[model samples]
Target: MIDVILADGFSMLTTTLILEALRFVNLAHRRKAFDWTIKGVQSQSPRASNGFTFSAQRSFEANAEPAELVFLNASYFPDAAASPELLAWLRNA
Candidate 1:
């Protein structure tokens, strides 16, 4: 799994849980700035820094790390949506 460790162990945990839940349905995700979208949920573009892992580790002894998951984008997804209902609409279309 790709990891984008920004900050806040709690937030990271939440992101991890959501990430895993989406994976079960074979979710396709991508990043562009902070523009994030999911098939069946509110679209929230998480802001993560590219230098979190190495830099944060050395700087603040962070618990999370940042890795490239750029390929996980809307274009690769099977019908994009801000929400699952929207995904359903996309499928129908």
Candidate 2:
């Protein structure tokens, strides 16, 4: 499973492209080659720089099991959205 950690003002285009690539791989293999979940650093629904909003499965929690792969999508002043909890989670991950 893959975890996509979204930050406020993330790049929508980049995120979608990554998702589509994974989907393509699954289609080519004719199996569930990859499974992914969207997670937020602070808000459950993080807004992109283009003003598009994405509904994340959940917020990053300390107890949550880390995924095999992780992607951090952020743009435009990402530091503003960084929290201690998120930093800790990333460090432990």
Candidate 3:
């Protein structure tokens, strides 16, 4: 499984491109070769710097099982106050 960890203000194009490539590969193979889950550091939906808001399937938690692969996508500076929690999760991950 592939996990997409989206940061606030993440690039829509970048996410789309990556997901599209995986989608194409699945089509070519005629099977679900790649499966992804979009997750947020917080429970709230993230809003991009360009004003694009998107929802995540789940929020990162310390006890949650890790995915086979993780994609970290961040396009803008994250709020300083929230960094520690994210950092801790990353460190543990």
Compute the lDDT for candidate 2. Answer: 0.87
lDDT of each: 0.31, 0.87, 0.76
* Order of the predicted models by lDDT, top scorer first: 2, 3, 1
The candidate 3 region of ten consecutive residues with least summed lDDT is 77-86
Most lDDT-accurate candidate: 2
CA deviation > 4 Å runs, candidate 3: 78-82
TM-score of each: 0.22, 0.91, 0.81
Q: Per-residue lDDT for 1-93 in model 2, tens only?
A: 999988889999989999999999999999999999999876899899999889999987767878989898877767976777767777777
Q: Model 2: residues >4 Å from true position, as ranges?
A: none
What TM-score, to 2 decimals, does candidate 1 have? Answer: 0.22
Expressed as tens digits, the lDDT of each residue in 1-93 for candidate 1 is 333222221233445455566564454444323332222112233222221221222211122232333122222222332345433433343
Clashing pairs in 3: none
